[model samples]
Target: MIVDRQGRRFRNLRISLTSACNYACTYCVPDGKRLVAAQDELSADAMIQAVAYLIEAAGIERLRITGGEPLVSPKLEALLRGVSQLGLDDISLTSNGQLLTRKLPLLLETGIRRLNISLDTLDPEAFRRIARGGDLFSVLEGLDQARAAGLKIKLNMVPLRGQNLDQVLPLLDYCLERGFELRFIELMRMGHLARAGQNFQQQFVGLPELLALIGERYEYAQADAPVDATALRYKIAGRGYFGVIANESVPFCRSCSRLRLSSTGWLHGCLSSSNRHYVGDLLDKPRHQALPALQGLLVKALGDKQELAFAGGTTIMKIIGG
Candidate 1:
């Protein structure tokens, strides 16, 4: 088992299968004229093999499949099948919910038990604006499909100050009425923001304020949302449940129990920075050597995990498969 300096055991793995996405959310992958070539991505088979090795070496019991849009990958079903073959304790996916209407049946058949759909706005126009070219109705249909397939679904919303904050109550009403879990995530800094001269520090909303507002109308239960280190979960008084991911305002690094593997084959010890180790290079080496190297790297990285530093910057959530 890999233990961090704070004694948190790493038992979860999040893997990004691809960086390509169908939707261009303004906050996520804003309209950029030039596209980064896709030559750097890891092949599906290599990803599966690496995950198998990691699970064996670290005893990771939970796995989350993520992407710019995981459903955008044609081989998503096959990948899920491979993950199931690993006998993981839990398997889930984070998607944009655009293609889910057509893929939900196939996904359920492949052993995916839980899903998280990123839907930042409840208004049709607002959704189109935030997601750039997304259809709000398509996502709603996808949610219905997922529910019918018996998959536990969670709505992931990124609350921006001037953007979708107004839709908070409406989004909660929709979730509570439909009995679906909803999560409100704070915007975070990532790639290109620094170069673009944008301030990440001012882009976040305080969790206390958001929670206080919800508390006025609902009761929340604290639970875990594994992908995020700063997630505080809750269950609506008489409605359903929801979560708040306050990455910028509140850092939960001490309790972090997961590691992220990028689609390009880099292992990130922490998600806020670009610091990572290349696990792909060790693929050609013997298992004994590769496993120990991975463990040592994780141990060292965890020992060096940065404390909460709130400087403004940006990284594409899609690139990191957040």
Candidate 2:
């Protein structure tokens, strides 16, 4: 096991393929900023090497490909194929769904079986306003295509207090009606909002209030969650299941077994922790030659992992994949 100083074993790895996204979401991508240029990013072969090292050295079997928008990556299919060849137990993706309709078939062919789509609002006007000119119809079409492709789908909604908070019921109803799992993510005090000079506290809505709102209409019970999962899953009476990722109100630092690899190749042991180590540099050599140094750097990062849970401060979520 790849155990940290706090004894949290690393089993999940989230990799950012690129920072270039089409939509400028208010919560995620504020001003259409790309941390690293497309040309300057790592190649598919390098990503394959990075994943191999993580799986062998860190014991991470579950992988999730994320990005400013992963579907938009020119080499996405190649990267997915490379990682899938490793025989991983689970290969999933977190995307904005702008290009998913066109890419779903290629994605499934490349071995992506699970998808977490970011759909904040059902109202087209709200979507355009929050997502900065994104088409609600395109994302909707993408969802339809994903369902038809037989992929497990999860809807991720970051409900800000004044923003999409009112659309919670509509969003949940849409997901429940379609038998798609839904997860409500609390507004994290980091990334685009911070960079935009927006206060997360002002937009924050804790899980209690969210659940209470759902409880008014249906009886709900807590359900089982994955060993290292941060979301608290629940089953509602007469309704489908849903979850809440209460990172701000109730941080899961104690059970966080996930590691983040930025598009630029930096290793982050904890999401909110600013301390990062460059693992990309080691990818230039053969896997056998790079293993020792990669293992050392991962251990160093584990030591730097946060002992206590705290709100995110410095890291950009888009750069590391939210």
Candidate 3:
């Protein structure tokens, strides 16, 4: 199996197919900004081939498809089918859930068994305002479709101060009632808004406090893993189970077994670090040569993995697939 320098096993791979997104979330793409042009992006075929190479070389067991909005990628179902054919043990996708209502069945048909949908607010107006142009009803419909498809669905909530924090209890209530997993992710220090004036401390909320509040009705089950995961999973006092992911105010740099493949074909060794290795350039190289080079780079980066320097820093969720 391929192992990076920090002894972090390379088992999970997150690949971003495209950087283009339909909605301009206030915290993500923001209001007015030009996104990456489509002309310079990798085609579907190239992405599949690259994934195949990585799997063959590193023995990667799980793959996650992410993007500005993975569903928006033209013929995304076809692309997922290609990845499914690779025989990876787990194949998942993280989407904004806007287009999922219409494509849920098709995605399931393509062998997508897991989904993590981003939904920050329960209010229609708040959803529209934060997500820019998203309709809360559409996202809810998509959630229903996912449940109907029997896929393991997780709700990804980004809690921003003065934004969606007040909805936490409501989200938990929804999850407990619906038997869905609720993951409250703290905003990371990478994004158009974060760079502008988003205060990390003000927006930051610790996992312990969040879990304590939920403790009123739930009992947490901590994982044995070493990674600093924010998702404090728990059973809702014989009712149901859910989780929370805290990225800020608490960092999980060590034991980070995940690697990110950007839309541009760069492999990010660590989420907090800007260091990356280009895999696209080696696409044409012989497998014998390319595999070792890729492995070597990963190993080196793993060794270099450092703890997050600050509560907030670079590395947006979109860039690496939140």
Candidate 4:
């Protein structure tokens, strides 16, 4: 395993099952249409092959199934079933929750214990505005269904300054009441936001500002988090916990033990860096031929990690697993 100078190694892997998504989230894409799968997306068998190889080559222990949206991917079941049989220490999924209810049985059967659902607000109008094509009612219903199924839920909210800024308190309150941890992800400088500095500045909500808003209603204290955990967590006494994935203001780059795999077979060591290792061809080769080459690519991926802060980049979050 390649550990950076900061003493971080790849134990966690995020796989983008497909580049395709059903919702045109404003923060994800500029327009209303959903992101389409890449023309040269790898097959489900190919992706599973890569994951099997990475488990041996990179010493990956945990897997987070992501996507443009994993639920919409035709290969989701195959990927999930294949990876589950690999004996990973942990396996989770992150989605927009649009199809959670419909996919609940599949998830439960495949052993998905926890998940992160991206929801910006509780208000119907604002929800529709933020996620152009998704129905808020359906999303909420899915969340409820997942919860009832005994799946631990975390709600991921990216607070935009002028848009869902007021959603901070309400969303947190909603999560607390329903036993879900609300993770406030500070707006990342990616995709279209990377090119438009002014627009990003206008919309970006830092961690401090977010805490101030939540502090107005909840009395919380700093809480312990796993060393490589992305979110800096907090607890509000009798209520449940909430977290902040403050990539900008309180960057967790030093202890970021994550590697991302795009559906097209690129391995990204750091979200802030553009370096990617293509192993699509390797996935097709015999194990003996692939492992030696894939191990070298793992080293190059970890070599791209920054020692401290995350300097934002222009990679579309929708293209890679966000």
Candidate 5:
């Protein structure tokens, strides 16, 4: 029942299954150290309990399972196995596709019909240079396998100047041809990028420039999106849809209804804020005892949401999930 001053409430929850990532993408990890799972990550059962508790506590209607790379998390299948029966409106996953092919059967059996995969470029060298890890061939093959498996896939690409900005159009063509939605996420001033100063500004790309690049080959118009949807959606005439998560040019903080829970059990209300509420212990407590405390904490979490623009934060996106 708690809503922010801007009328935003927790309708969507993104839970990070693990903090450990297989890839050290340049944008995500400026220092090039791969993230590792926290020593105290919650067990699969406890996380499932939290999801159920939150359903009643905050009226969460959607769930996105994320990770340092969720496929790398050993608890993924078990977690999904338990979460699938909860009857949430939808359950999706976000991954780097490094292990999607291996996990496709688990995803299908668990009824995960849609997912978001991060793929910035199709070039092998660029993939290595940017992701800093993983085989692009494996990822590409995984994508094909998932597509053939009848999964509704969406591709996420962060457009950065001097990095893979040139790949935007080709990547879009790749998505459009395959019936996958391509989402161009504008680079944010987050993590080390927050302190990157001129370098951050230099490499950062915005919506106008992204549209201009895509406009060179195709025409598109603004399309409808959920009120709390982060990405601004668009649809082309003959091609499939594309979206722009223009955090810089068109901040959607006012309508942001996402609540992030790290694998080790911390509720992050806003990505741009450092504040986090610890609800791990509550997950093990009785409902009567946990519900009251968790609801109180949910209010604090909701209050932590940004009022307008995303000012950015020092916390790495992997720590809390993307």
Candidate 6:
């Protein structure tokens, strides 16, 4: 296993297919501030080869395909097909659900059985405002299609203080009725949101308050997640499972088993920093030579993995492929 110096084995690999996106979420890639890679992104074959080497060398079994929005990448389907053929234990995708309705069949055909959709609020106006001109109806249609496709669905919600907090209980009800897992991520002060003028303090909400509110209404118990998983999961009795990814309020750095690969093939050990090592160069080497070289860099990087600092970063969430 790819155990870091701290003894955290890295088993999950998150790869970004593209830095392009459709929705302009306020907390993520805000309006007029999208950052696409200047360097050409690795092609489907190259991505597969790189990931295959990592899977073998690092013993990474679980793979997650992310992006500014993964569906935007034309090479996504091919990439997924190639990686799935490697016999990886799990393969999942994280998307905004904008174009997912039409691509559901292709996604499943390409071997992605699990999906995480970014759906912050159930309200249409709130969605548009928060997502900066996103269509809530289209996302709903995508969700319907995903459920019909028999995919394990998880809704990733970032609860802003005054924005989606009102819809919290309603969102829970919706997820429970549909048997979908709900993950509430605390509003992180990173990238554009870290600006002094962004008023990030006003938008922040702690996980404790959310848990207390949910506990008051539902009979929920802490559910066991994988040792390396970041989210603290809970199963609300007779309803469905929910998770609180309190990265800031209750940091899960000690158990983080993820290493993110950007669209341009940059490797990031931490989510809060823009300092990424260029792993793409190793892809140019022959398979036999690349494996050992890539493994060495990964081991050195993991050895230097440090706890995250959530303030003052220019790299947007899309570029990091979170």
- What is model 5's C-alpha RMSD? 0.8
For model 4, residues 294-319, the per-residue Cα lDDT tens digits are: 98998889998888888877788978
Candidate 6 per-residue C-alpha lDDT over 1-322 given as tens digits, one digit per residue, 9 for 90 to 100: 6675567766889998888887778888656554454468888888898788888888888899998888878888789789989989999999999998878889978878899999999999899888885688999999998898899999999989888898888899999999899999988766778673547878887888899878778988899997767788999777789999887787777777788788888777667656677878888888788888777777765754555534445677787677
1 or 4, which is superior by TM-score?
A: 4
Residue 2 lDDT in model 5?
85
**Rank ordering of all candidates by lDDT, starting from the highest:** 5, 4, 2, 6, 1, 3
Give the runs in model 2 whose Cα sits over 4 Å from its true position.
Answer: 32-39, 192-198
In model 6, which regions exceed 4 Å deviation?
32-39, 195-198, 307-313
For each of the candidates, the C-alpha root-mean-square deviation to the true structure, in angstroms, is 2.7, 1.9, 2.6, 1.0, 0.8, 2.0
Clashing pairs in 6: none
- For residues 144-213, write the lDDT of model 2, one tens digit per residue: 8888878899999988777788889889899998889999998876765544444766787899999988
Can you list the residue pairs that collide in candidate 5? none
User: Model 3: what TM-score?
Assistant: 0.89
**Candidate 3 C-alpha lDDT tens digits along 73-187:** 7848667878888989889999989999888878878888888888888999888778877689989888887887788888888777787777888988887777687888766
Sort every candidate by TM-score, greatest first.
5, 4, 2, 6, 1, 3
What value does the lDDT take at residue 287 in candidate 2? 74
RMSD of 6: 2.0
Write model 1 residue lDDT over 68-102, tens digit each, in one string. Answer: 77888865876887778988899899988888888
lDDT of each: 0.76, 0.83, 0.73, 0.90, 0.93, 0.82
Top candidate on TM-score is 5
Question: Each model's TM-score, in the order given?
Answer: 0.90, 0.94, 0.89, 0.98, 0.99, 0.93
Question: Global CA lDDT of candidate 2, please?
Answer: 0.83
